[model samples]
Target: MNSASMHPSDTNVGMMLVISAPSGTGKSTLIRRLTTEFNAFTFSVSCTTRAPRPGEVDGREYHFLTREEFLRRREEKYFAEWAEVHGNLYGTPRQTTMDLLALGRDVIFDIDVQGARQIKSNMGQGCYVFVFPPSRDALEKRLTGRGTDSEETIIRRLAAARHEIADSQWFDHWVINDELDSAYQELRAIYLAEKTRPAYRASWQAALSRQWGVS
Candidate 1:
């Protein structure tokens, strides 16, 4: 009922962050480390039209869906944001995040720049952070070294990455993944600092902070 408190509608003021990086730049690894290290933050799972890769589970790695099902959801306007990448459609459904954050849990998204923009615009509580590698060459080597794509495909990806890398400024913070441990520490610091933002801390009032040993 008060403006200083979380609006009766909006929730999760700890800061919802969008973390992005060029392919093979270790964004996945960083996200894993981040979620594991910070008990309060969680990686938000996405929904996609692509089939699950080996070892990926349904509703975990991604919410795998048929193209028809994906388009049907699109028609219903159920996605917070959606994109077609490499011939497959990927999206983040709004409800899962809404439910989690409504319960006072922080949500972290490993989405691309475009998705990040959409979510930031739609969800005012969210923040965007870009995890960047040192150089184009390093990104190239990292992707190719995995042996997942052909030389031609890698070239195409690198070209695409150039544009994405330029888009980092579109985010609130750009943390370079040049040194893994250092970057992780810095990202963790952002979490700590965001928690102290007056707006965010005020959401803690008494109940939520009590869960984390905060006043």
Candidate 2:
């Protein structure tokens, strides 16, 4: 059906896309390319009690908050999902996400397994994708090649990655980042397909109803 033929309200159906992956799976790069190539996609900025990294701006990368403020907001249930990672508290703002969805903007989340689980429990609708490296050896090479972590830290992260990948079985889709271009194409395909699902396009049902004179 031609979306242009439908009324604004009828065609304005939004979606949420959640993506999670192991630390060295290059998940961030895939998400970056998707958001860059799609104008309709909005990356959800999370709230965090951690200090902003150099060159990170407020409300862009994260909504930086004090520890006390983060806790207060948590208590008020302002976050859809909140988790403490590596001693810092991070959360997705509940109202902001809902408002974006109501406006027909597809929101993309770059979160971890813990955050993904919370989001699944709280909001049952959304396409969840998990990215994986081709092999554990590749993941270790990627992590070690970065030269940012100590050997001990790298070992710990590898163990964490195994657990994260195990939990990924529940995700709707999985993209193996063996080749960057191929992996990105698969990821984009998932997003495009999900967008076309009848459940996500309310206008299809409305248009059909009008044609059948069901109202």
TM-score of candidate 1 to 2 decimals: 0.78
Q: How many residue pairs collide in each prediction?
A: 0, 0
lDDT of 2 by residue, 79-108 (tens): 889998899999999889888888889999
Best by TM-score: 2
Give the Å shift of residue 135 in candidate 2: 0.5
Whole-model lDDT per candidate: 0.79, 0.89
TM-score of each: 0.78, 0.89
Angstrom error at residue 114, model 2: 0.8
Residue 41 displacement in candidate 1 (angstroms): 2.6
Error of 1 at 118 (Å): 1.8
